[model samples]
Target chain A: MTAAVRRRAGLRELGLGLALPFVLVVIWEAAGRAGVVPQGILPAPSLVAAAWRDWAFADPGLGLNPYLGTWGETVLFSARRVFTGFVCAILIGVPMGIMIGWNRMVAGAVDPLIQSLRPIPITAWLPFAIAVFGIRDAGAVFLIALGAFFPIVVNATAGARDVPRNLIRAARMMGANERQLLLRVVLPAALPNIFTGMRLGLGIAWTAVIVAEIVAVKSGLGYVLWDAYYVGRMDVVIADMVSIGIAGFLSDRVLVAVQLRVLHWKQAVRA
Target chain B: MTDAVAIRGLRKVFEGRAGAVEALAAIDMTLAEGEFACILGPSGCGKSTLLNVIAGFEAPTEGSASVFGAPVSAPGPDRAVVFQEASLFPWLSVRDNVTFGPRMLGRPKDETDALARRFLDLVGLSGFEHHLPDQLSGGMKQRVGIARCLILNPRVYLMDEPFGALDAQTRMQMQELLTHVWDQARGTVLFITHDIDEAIFLADTVYVMTARPGRMRSRIAIELPRPRSIDLLTDPRFNALRADILRQIREEAIKAMAEEERARR
Candidate 1:
């Protein structure tokens, strides 16, 4: 209840969360050092951290290592793609979804097409993406956008559709024209759902960027991940995987912060 | 002079999987300008459906509802509604919800804000302007609902059991608040409720409806004095009006229950 008590509770939760991963890493390190685990296949946490440090902070002139001093750029490349693709997904999805949910004609015309195409995985589009965009960043962006679009649109539709009937009537009775009703009432009402879709879409966007990077492009964490593994630099591969996880987690946190700001009333309702 | 609200042979039917369910068979009513009328009925007596028709939320199957001689074709700010659940935009603060109608009508912000303040104050929600609907109690939310409609300065107010969900004490307080508000704003109101006390306390005229296939059973004029308060609840005349309306509603409620039991069998 008190601020001090709350802070202590938060600290305890953090410590508990870290304890299991810390113990796991310690056991893993012990197994590696004792030669009970093969180091070539899976390196210790220390090795991954050391390799990540070099990849992040090492002087570029010191060695022929391709990963030297490239961690930030590699992450930026993947992050930028995810950001652009996710934005595109939101731009196309939210309006399309609102329309589909709000109007029967739009739903009839477009929903079936989206539903049918949604079953096709992003991986399935890889060949087509490479063929059309020809291994460029555009191909990666296209795949990421397409991959993230489904969840965003689907959740947006659900959000828009589930608006309370009374709220609609209340808006109409308040003299809100159709456009004003949708923008002022329906949109705000569906915002909690829109955020839900965006979070799911962002996760998919990260997946999409990696898939795009691994096959269709050359400069992101995904590219380095595959490149490192081929050369048996499992340390770099593991570090890249950790970086992707951290990036994805951080992006999700940013979205959650925005959601909290926008849907504070929704949170109060739930509380 | 055109009546504030006029309905003639209004009928509503729902074509469900079970076939056509007649909600309102035939209903007729009229309210003079600035009159406060209450429709008291048993549950499922098409009382809300009647309000919905008048509010332009639902179309009548067989007849017409008009406001100030204009056929009700669509919902508009001229006929504001205070729903049973209060239906305040959950995302909006009390101030925002109260201002919603005026804002939607493109009224000047300063004018709307002042109106919102006055109405919210009228309902005793002046300090709670920043509170969301979720944060407010049932009575407080209903106050916001009343304030929002009052802010519109509508010709008619269609309320569908606005205090039905509140506790007995809160409901009484709300009824008093509403009467106090009506004294200030003075719009024609068609309030729907099942409570005999609420009807007697608030209405200039009370229209009691019968069970399913609901039709207007009786119309009782409450000759109670203006600016009525909770003190009026214990008045001898108030008790007499309550007893009279209670008997009619009780008969309808029994019929509704019997119909339900027969349908179940």
Candidate 2:
């Protein structure tokens, strides 16, 4: 294919992706302007966009509006919590998962405990988190980390366990010691599964952060959402919701980009 | 020097949920250094189990196997294996898979890379260094498996039906490639196959094994010309060897079928 044709195809894909959102926005704007949507129940996309702009760029001198110019700070706060909690989850969960999957003794000792605790919802742990860490950032981080850990650990265990027996035998025959077997063969073999778990865990991490911010913390998008709703500022609530969605989407994209790079060999085969 | 590999009264019995299944019994074999030997048998005749015992991937229930006078206990670099499925690490590129052994042993990067390049060329996969196993055809993947083992410069090459999954055309091409590679490398090879042609084409000695509770029934020496080629398959001498082996295996296969019927009853 010529470069021009390829470029045209690329543009067509972009247009196709944006078409639905553009249509939805137009319909939403028309409904709000026509008063077909109940007043103050659902804000128009335009109104939410305006509110979001003010929340992000309006000067604090305009005063008295807590959300004014606080979008960056709030996003940062939530993002920081998610990042910290997810990192902690990865550090503890990955090694623990590998151990549980690699060794029968380790599985026997820890797998039952994990399976038993997994059934309890992250929201159910909110009270316990609050009691332990006391409505601070620690409580929020704890909740996020705990929520994300289950999927990460579970997937990692499955990944490690499911490594082909022949790969292990091949590695051993190649003079790999037990440590080398785990690091070079088993770990790399388990990577695709580990990435799957991480993606799932990250999605849960975003949810946990929003939940924690709503109940136990006062500085993020979730807090803004609740506070704006209480004040009857539906526009601000809508903007906050959109902000959270964008943040979750962008973070997930970042992970997928990294996964694609790491699993490029897998991609090449599929391609 | 001691034999490259020796096995004495080797037996393997798998304890399954159904009952104890005897896979191999009273198997004795020996291979000289730089020899290529193939174990030919019917399906489920414990040929693969015997190869695994020699490769140290499986322990014999009775008696023992040794490589160069050392008792086989665990898999090592000295006994590199080429599994039937190729078993190349899917995540690694062809170059990486080929160099896995040398890299694992912490050989100098420059030396290992040179060695990898040499063997990749030897296997006719020189241009596919960056390809993943899944991207390659069955024959190419098997070639990579061969290169991966060859890079180790092993004392014994244990191949378990290395071309068993390929199409007939690909299998014949691979057999020719194997003969060329084996001609140059000259390592002791213990290849397991149910293919009579493959056994005769590749081995210096073909050990025909009996059906399960498998024992070494006969060993036939192939006096085929050196640096053999596919044309040898039509040679009168090659035809004679093929006929003799085929006759023995046909009887074993029939007996195995009868045994299966008995078990079913």
Top candidate when judged by lDDT against the true structure? 2
lDDT of 1 by residue, B47-95 (tens): 8989888888888999999999999998998998998898888888899
Model 2, B178-218: lDDT tens digits are 99988888889999998999999999999999999899999
Q: A16-55 in candidate 1: lDDT tens per residue?
A: 9999999999999999889887889999888999999999
Which is the leading candidate under TM-score?
1
Candidate 2 interface RMS? 1.2
Q: How far is candidate 1 from the true structure (C-alpha RMSD, Å)?
A: 1.7
lDDT of 2 by residue, A71-139 (tens): 999999999999999999999999999999999999999999999999999999998999989979999
- Tell me how far the alpha carbon of residue A40 in candidate 2 is from the true structure, in angstroms, after superposition: 3.0
Clashing pairs in 1: none
Taking the candidates in order, what DockQ does each have?
0.74, 0.76
Task: Judge the docking of candidate 1 as incorrect, acceptable, medium or high.
Answer: medium
Candidate 2, residue B193: CA error in Å? 0.9
Candidate 2 lDDT:
0.92
Which residue pairs clash within candidate 2? none
> What overall lDDT goes with each candidate model?
0.90, 0.92
